[model samples]
Target: MDSNDFAKFLSRISSTPLRVLDTSIPNSKYIYLDLSYDNSNLEKIDASSSESLSRFVNSHIKLHHALVAFGGYNEIRSIYQRSNHFNINQETERNVHLGIDLWCGTNTPIYAPIDARVHSFKNNKNHGDYGPTIILKHVIKDVLFYTLYGHLSMDSILNLKVGQFFKKGDCIARLGDSDVNGDYPPHLHFQIIKDIESYTGDYPGVCSKNDLDFYLKNCPDPNLILKLA
Candidate 1:
């Protein structure tokens, strides 16, 4: 199937929203967060500092009476400027986020929203990168795809093996703190990939404007399944 068809298939998989976090945490508790350059509120804090960003995010959550701050799919963010990994050049800055980030406290349990088998797992230790990551392969109605979980604790992949199976709602991992999560505040970077190419354990979570069109289609908005609204 094509990208558009795949996205429709994903949305039709479950009428109700799926959960990668605790099923007990209702969707009402998830507040949308905007870290885009257009958000004037970010100027008040040091976006480069993990601690400062954490405080800003937490405050937003508390202000809305929310337990989680979630957003960033296809968002053009300025926080990425602090990392050279994303700003290798001026014209090709990888600032457009490809995943839906769920910002919450560390050690929060992460679950598999659908039946899957481990495709790969790795600890990407680069600054401002996904620290511990796991990619799971899924096939439904004979269409194959993958889901990526990033910023996971070290323990999440210690005993993990390729091809290990996980039923829906199985505890897959826990959130990692900045110490291990690429110097960012605790958050889960969840992405859905229709075609992962030959990548293993890691895929570009952000893309430049020059490549946004391709990335957007290959990595459709994860909310198609999560349906956070």
Candidate 2:
């Protein structure tokens, strides 16, 4: 299926919104966060410091009376400059985020939004990487797609195996801290992939401007499933 058709298929997966976080946490408790370079407020803080970013994220949640601060699909960020993993140079810098991040506390349980089987799992140990990641294969109406969960706890993948089945709402993993989550504040990097290509446990969560169009098509806005306002 084409990207447009794939997005429509995802939208019709369920009559109600999907839940990757706790089901009890109402959608009203989720707030939109702008970490883009355009947010001048970020200039005052050290974006490279995990502690600083954590403080910023937590405070935003508290200030908004929210349980989760989420956004960043297609957002252009400058925080990636802290690690060469995201930026080799100006032209090749992959600063545009391709996923929606749910900023919450570490150890927060993450759930499978729908029925799926483990396709792959890996510990991406590079600086500013996903840390522990899991990709799940989902086939609904015979249209195959994948969902990626990134920045998870070590124990999340300790005994996980490929092809393991998980029913919808199953506890798949928990959020990881800065120590194990690529030195960033605790957050779930959730993405949807139409064509996974040869990618395994990890896929490009961010893309350079030159590749934005292609990546956007392959990885549709995760909100198509989450439906977070």
Candidate 3:
């Protein structure tokens, strides 16, 4: 996909504000938010309880550890390996996170930060997967790349076409419900991609610990554009 055109595309749509969610509700059960997203000790987990179980999986499974989490434009993903389903991408041998997850309530408005063309999209219905997803191609300084917005409402894809052009800051998708968005608390999963590697709606949001080198190289820190933390 052409990324340079995408950079030029983002240049025109600067009217919209990017957003992060206030997930700290009375019963949010997220005690650690007060500390930091990169807290290493929080991940020391016990299988008997659900608290921080997601952290245990995310932290240990991936050797790189949390660089900068939560509030930032850092790509995020929800929980996995709570059970024994092979279809569900678990953090077993692979680090197993493909995109950035933004914590918030359901139907949180998800907007485009840069201009892009619809590279591909799909509704991947596997458990713990992106229920409804979209991928876009963008370019900056003649550099070709792409971004992925997953766990989005299925309705967002309606009337969307492969070649459809979207301006930056446009309302493109909404944070989907658990029933529609991989059965986790509502959030937005975003990722930056240097190359699509022939996948369409389905990209490897999760990667094996062995493959972190390649993924990190191709997937630059999204914070470059999304400084939302």
Please name the candidate that would achieve the greatest lDDT relative to the true structure.
Answer: 1
RMSD of every candidate to native, in Å, equals 0.6, 0.7, 8.1
Output the lDDT of residue 64, model 2.
96
TM-score per prediction, in order, is 0.99, 0.99, 0.67
Cα lDDT tens digits, model 1, 6-28, are 89999999999999999889999
User: What digit string (tens of lDDT, one per residue) describes model 3 on residues 1-229?
Assistant: 3445443443333333332233222222222131223555545544323334445434432443332234322223223444233233444443346455565556777776677788988998877677899988876557667888888888988778897787776777887876787765556778888778999986867665667767766665554455443
Regions more than 4 Å wrong, model 3: 1-78, 83-92, 96-98
The TM-score that candidate 2 achieves is 0.99
Alpha-carbon deviation at 45 in model 3, angstroms: 9.6
Superposition-based RMSD of candidate 3 using all C-alpha atoms, in angstroms: 8.1
Worst 10 residues of 1 by lDDT: 1-10
- lDDT for residue 220 in candidate 3, whole number 0-100: 54
Candidate order, lDDT descending? 1, 2, 3
The TM-score obtained by model 3 is 0.67
TM-score of 1: 0.99
Error of 3 at 47 (Å): 9.0
